[model samples]
Target: MLTSLAIRNVVLIEALDLEFGAGLSVLTGETGAGKSILLDSLGLALGARADSGLVRAGETQASVVAAFEPPAGNTRAAALLADNGIEMEPGEPLLIRRTLKADGGSRAFVNDQPCSAALLRDLGGMLVEIHGQHDDRGLLNPRGHRALLDAYGRCDAAAVASAHAAWRAAAATLADARATVDNAARDRDYLTHAVEELSKFAPEPGEEEILAAERATMQKGARLSDDLAAVSDCLTGSDGGLAQLRQAARRLDRIAGEDAALAAVLEALDRAVVEAGEAEDRLAEAAEALSFDPARLDAIETRLFDLRGLARKHQVAPDDLAALRDEMAAKLAAIEGGEEHLAALEKDVAVKADAYRAAAQTLSAERQLAAGRLDAAVAGELAPLKLDAARFRTVVAALDEGQWSAQGTDRVEFEISTNPGAPFAPLAKIASGGELSRFILALKVALAERGGADTLIFDEIDRGVGGAVADAIGERLSRLAESNQILVVTHSPQVAARGAGHLLIAKSSDGTVTRTGVHALDAAERREEIARMLSGAEITAEARAQAERLLERV
Candidate 1:
């Protein structure tokens, strides 16, 4: 239930603070008394869209705040707050504030802590529902119709929980199956190439790096092969160098007999000649091995190209291809054996679908029972509201094939007939403004305990109504207050008389500034306000006596 509302610098309202009680409260004034402005301020605090024009002429920003005292031990409120990352204990009061700047930017807060407008909207939805004169379409919506039926049936929580769980389970199974199928299709071609490449190379992890280094060294030496060959030829490869050295050594050895010094020199020359011959032979062998083979180079290029190409195709580096191949193989294996897994998933989906169908059917049956009672109750409310001929009907249609959803498959709508012998139509299309209000009142009255948020606000619910019909509407609102707080802005004296509290919306102009003000009415003040509503701008003794009798009768 709302505890208080405060508004600052909002259009005609410079500043205002209003406190609420736990029953039906009425706000009354002549037209243009800023009754709509009050509701708009509350809407702004509840996270409605803001416009910079709502700010007062001299003010840079407009602000509104609403405070709520959530019912003790209300699990729904506690869970909702917790889910939003708000820290509040059970039974604690919650405050929401919204501020808008002249530049059109806005900020929202929960419990004075910075929050998003979305969060405020979410919390506000749980705490208040504002129905205005233009809102006759709420009951016409098929989505809300089911909720109404559930509230009437008192099975909303259980039915919604079961359907949500079943839908999620089925959705999960379908998603997993779809991902498996997509992966198998993507990897179909790659799997064969991967297996072939791994088979041929049989390459150890570091084998490529070692082989690449050896190949580079050998190629570099091979590049200078022609120079090495020329050196070898000049030294001794089928050439005259070794022969000349041998002849010189022989001539020196023969001449050594003539001189002993000559013999020593011959011995040194012979050792040198032998060393040169050994050196030439080694050079010739090295020249022969230094030749390059184009065929080996081609093989190395082809192997590297295959690894790199495969890596590019798979969006991985060449070295990481090994891991990618293994992963692809695993996926292929899963797909190959997908039939067994797919069957399991299908079974699970079927089970959840059946569970959802059963729950929806059971809920539908209960709704049918509840619908009869609702129709009876609404029909009883019609005569007093001057619509004795009108008919209120809850229509339900089951889907041909069960549709799994958050709210189940049964399509529900509230239909009405405003005149005798007329065909029933959707409530939105059939009812007039006053008729809709009366119908809404009847619905609210019937499900007062089970329907709605902690606070319900009706802006001009008594529109297009007066006399006995107006009194009937007021009676229903009073009954609705037994379970939830209700606020009504009205022009009907009967409605104002029925309120446990009455507030007067009056506008007073001070020079250039016009401000709207609200004041809680005492007993005498209430009578005067009711008299004014009953008469007009002028209040008479007869109007006062009538207002007094109306109050007494209530």
Candidate 2:
């Protein structure tokens, strides 16, 4: 149930804080005293669309916070909050806040932690349901009629949902397989040719990098050949370092043993001769390693171009050529064996479709039974709201095959007849403003526990009728309060007096600033307010006595 609402700098309301209790609460005042403003503020916190014009003239922003304490066993709201990662514990108050900027942008928060407006709307839906004079939801919206009937029937919605999903998934698979077969059949020749061509090249992953690196090295090798050859000639040709060292060695060997120092010089000359021969051998090997044939360069270039051309044709990188070839191979295989596979998929789809049909038919039968009961229940509530002659009907009709959905193959609508001889018509098309409210009240009272809402707000539900008719609407509201908290904005004194808690919306001005205020009424104050509502602008002894009798009767 909504526990509290606080508004700051909202249009006519400069600052306001209100604590709400359980059961039916009524808000009453003169027409322009800001009763609608109060509901609007609450709506803002309930994730309704925000407008900068709601801000007070001198304020830069308007803020509203609504705190809700969910019932002990109601975990739907808790689950949603948990899914969004908002911190909330069972039985703890869930505070929803919205701050509207004067510039037309607003921020929303859950328990003071910043969140998106969508999350607030989702959570608010579970916490409160607003039924205003213009509201046409609940039974009036045909989209929800089937589900409402299912709920009344105690049908397994989850099972139906699962069956429907299974059928859809199977159908999707069959469709995709058929599409693939159709496309592949059209391109069978091309796919087969591509597979054969790619198999001959048999491109391997990472081979492109290796080949590119080898080509780069050979290109550089060609540029360095002249310098390498010149170095080789300088180190190993006649009169080069190796030949000159050997000549010196031979001369030293002839003068060996002429003196001790001369013998040492001959030994060093012989060692230099051996070392020079080794250096010459190494230089020859280095020249051989640098050797490349000019024709080989052309061959390498041709191979590189062939690989690039194929990559371009396939719209893939050189490295992805191998992957593309494998994909084409699979497509060819699919064409070769497609008919058998498609038959198997078709069988699967048929099986799933049969299962779904059975479930939907079973559900439809139960809905038919539930419909009769729902109509009877609604009929019981109609007479009490002074609609004894009206008829409330829940129509469940078969839909065409193409109209089948996850819910079922049925079109459900709530239709009504205002007179005994008139034909039943769609509720929205046939009911007047006051008649609609009364009609909705009957439906709501019949299906009050459907959504398990924490709070139900009715803005001017008793719009067109008064006296006995007004009292009857008040009686139903009181009955609704037994299961959920209800708030009604009313001009009917009977409805106002039926409220367990009463609030008066009043407007005042302090010379410079005008503001709206809400005050909880005490017993004595309640009597005065009720008297004023009954007589208008003037309270007489008779009105006070009548208010007392109304209070006593309750």
TM-score against native, each model: 0.69, 0.73
Per-residue lDDT for 1-554 in model 1, tens only?
Answer: 89899999998999999999989999998799899899889988887888898888889999998888854545566677778788876567888889999899999988778888877776676677777766633454566777878888775547656766876877797788769767786777777677676656554455457657656756876788878867766666445677677888889887889999999999888888888888887876776566557787667767767766766876876677677667767777777877777777788788777777778778778888988988888888888878788888988787666464667667778888888899989887777676676777777777654645778888777787688888888888988888889999888999999999999999999898899999999999999999998889889999999999999988
The 10 consecutive residues of candidate 1 with the worst lDDT sum are 133-142
Which stretches in model 2 have alpha-carbon errors above 4 Å?
Answer: 1-19, 30-129, 151-154, 216-299, 452-454, 462-472, 491-494, 506-517, 531-554
lDDT of 1: 0.80
Candidate 2: C-alpha RMSD to true structure equals 5.7
TM-score of candidate 2 against the unseen true structure: 0.73
lDDT of 2 by residue, 1-554 (tens): 88899999999999999999999999999999999888888888877889889999988999999987753556787788778788766557778889999999999999889988778776776788787766655456787777777777786656667888998998899899888888888998998888888899888788778777767777877988998878767777786877888788788778776788988988888888788778778877766766667788777777788888889998999899889889888877778889999899999999988988898888788888888998999999888777999998999899998998888877888899999899999988888777887888888788766764668888888897789989989999999998889999999989999999999999999898899999999999999999998998889999999999888888
Alpha carbon deviation, residue 240, candidate 2 (Å): 9.5
How many times do residue backbones clash in model 1? 0
Query: lDDT: which candidate is best?
Result: 2
Report lDDT (CA) for all predictions: 0.80, 0.85
